[model samples]
Target: MQEAAHTGVSEKSTIAPRKVLRHSVRGQILDALRAALVDGELAPGEIYSGPALGERFGVSATPVREAMQQLALEGAVECLPNRGFRVLTRTPRALAELAEVRALLEVPVMLRLARTLPASVWDSLRPAAAATADAAVVGDLPGYADADRAFHRAVLSLAGNEQLLQVAEDLHRRSQWPLPGAPRVRRADLVADAAEHVALLEALVAGDLAVVESLVREHFAGAAV
Candidate 1:
């Protein structure tokens, strides 16, 4: 009789487990650092040391160093020759340009999604937008920021185009700049934004692609201003 074939898991399964662990570690570090940078907890021009960050994150320096290198590659942080990592600061002009790019990329995708996706997806976005409005009302900037990200993500997800979603995400990250000494999201602005979302939802429900696109463009323009 032929020798019994091995019944154990394949080598690929063993290697895959380690790969997943490493990826999770790296992703955790990156997300924590990115949140700090965006929320102004890590100020512009502040130099970050790997050891310090590693300690703070309860990890060793290796993962933190890897994360910083990845961030530098993404242009979110700059590596000094001998010093450390510095967060990249965006100028007003640069922010405006990024906003324009975001509008161009996102609005069209949202419009297409609105016209094509099922109404249920649009309905699901309402709660996220309402939460964003509530956060703004309570002066919870971080909460508002989280909700804002969710709202946009929901809209992009409806597009059903992975490539376009990736492009929009890249643009969104680049658009995070200090708001010229203004609050990140003021109560009034939040209210207006919520209204705009409602209008977009109404247009989507009506299958009015033209109105949806116009509203999206106007919303971005208002935010950019």
Candidate 2:
């Protein structure tokens, strides 16, 4: 039998037990592969081999295969006959339609959360927003994408509606298609986005639902461009 390599554990071990670790490994592979596909790191129509992906992610083929199936189910990739998975191509019109759907779903959620949730609920969002701003400033597209998603998720989570939150998250995943092959980060866009976030924070603090809705719409519209 092959012996598993043992690494020294840290003093503060937040690592989950074996079963949880296996689940997390699968999730990590899924998310990483999805991000790569959406960000255009893996170009549309590009074929990917499970074994190669597993090697790249430093995991076994089983997890990579699982992740690919998940991506396929999400419409990010497709299983090809006698080949491997291929990234799905998205049209500009499709992306525009997706943006519209996201705006419709998310703006209302943000408004409701702003009106209902306490300021303390937004404490977690501040750091994520700040990180996004920093990433945008530095032209770190991958980091910015992660932080951007986190910021939106934080706001959606505060709404306390599980169905809405899931829908919003799905919309967000779909929206990532437009970003692939786009410029890393535009300074002017970042500045404008940061300013909008500040204004949003202020609106939340003041418990202004109307302003929050308007700002959310504006933010999503700006991102569409």
Candidate 3:
């Protein structure tokens, strides 16, 4: 078995409730693979076998292979010749380019939301930000990661453009994947990072576009996980 598919990894690090509920078995496998990629259980440049991943997830190899194919299509993993998939590695340059694109795409949208959206719209999204805070308080990286994305998604969804949201989400997921050779991020840092959401929310509520712009710009400047 490749070392990446170790069944003993903590339950939180693997796909659980949301993926299982919203996605097909193959979709769930694909999401798990993404989380594994982000959480560094599946290292860059490692070839992971479908059968081994099936054993870990308690699914058959067919679904695992299908899911892996999807990941390959997304360029998150590469389909090996007569084998399984190899996780792709990203350089600092690549990660920076992703962050740059996200800032270019998302930051302006967020600034516009802050300027044009009413307080009630931001009000409805407060719970998502709080959920991120809750996740951070407990030092839960996986939980924080999910909640953080939700909070941002809620903010972006207000633009009333699903296709834009979809594109932004793809970039977001790519940014979350682990950067090659970056140090393991500390849990305390995650807690600190989550705190910024509340601050950004406050700035939005206050209608301070300057602070909001700065916050949104800095928000995309996340350390590699």
Candidate 4:
């Protein structure tokens, strides 16, 4: 999926308005499905019909099928001939492998950023951090997921490397896919993750590389998501 960069798309950025009209419908449906996967509304291993999902999202089956096809390319789902798609299930071993990838990518960069970036750089992320906390307090898993993604993206943006951000962002999304047979998210877990972001930012501002590294490792170590 390294070629994903070839599309010249930053998942979070603004797009041309004309292009938005043509692409946003399918893209939005894809995003909604991704959130459903992470939020467990689309349970892993379940075969879901495009028409059925279209009914759920109030869209036509054509767009839903297109979106699911994109997700299938991302390895999030598998297409069945003449049928719908099946949500790909991730085992604990798979989750652990993903966590290891994230730790390798995120930890060292955070340590480097903590020492080099200015206090205001970390301060710039406070709004995303606050947004994460607000979503966590409300026990909104999808909301927290978005906010958490933004917060980490903001952090990695400081690296001045779009490729790094994109790669890490992809792994981050994969890591967040809901575990098969996992329990619903606990409010306490979201709150704890929010607190970790806060501390991570504080460490970044303090230029405490050790604390920043520790927090980054611990954050990925708890892989309930």
Q: lDDT for every model?
A: 0.68, 0.69, 0.75, 0.79
lDDT of 4 by residue, 175-196 (tens): 8887788998898999999989
Clashes (N, CA, C under 3 Å) per candidate: 0, 0, 0, 0
Question: Candidate 4 regions off by >4 Å?
Answer: 1-23
The weakest ten consecutive residues by lDDT in model 2 span 1-10
Q: Which ten residues in a row have the lowest lDDT in candidate 4?
A: 10-19
Clashes of 1: 0
**Candidate 3: which pairs clash?**
none
Question: What TM-score does structure 2 among the candidates reach?
Answer: 0.78
lDDT for 145 in candidate 2 is 66
Give each model a TM-score. 0.74, 0.78, 0.86, 0.87
**For candidate 1, lDDT tens digit of each residue in 20-74?**
2445898878776766665566666566666656656677777878989998877
lDDT of 1 at 57: 68
Off by over 4 Å in 1: 1-25, 179-187, 208-211
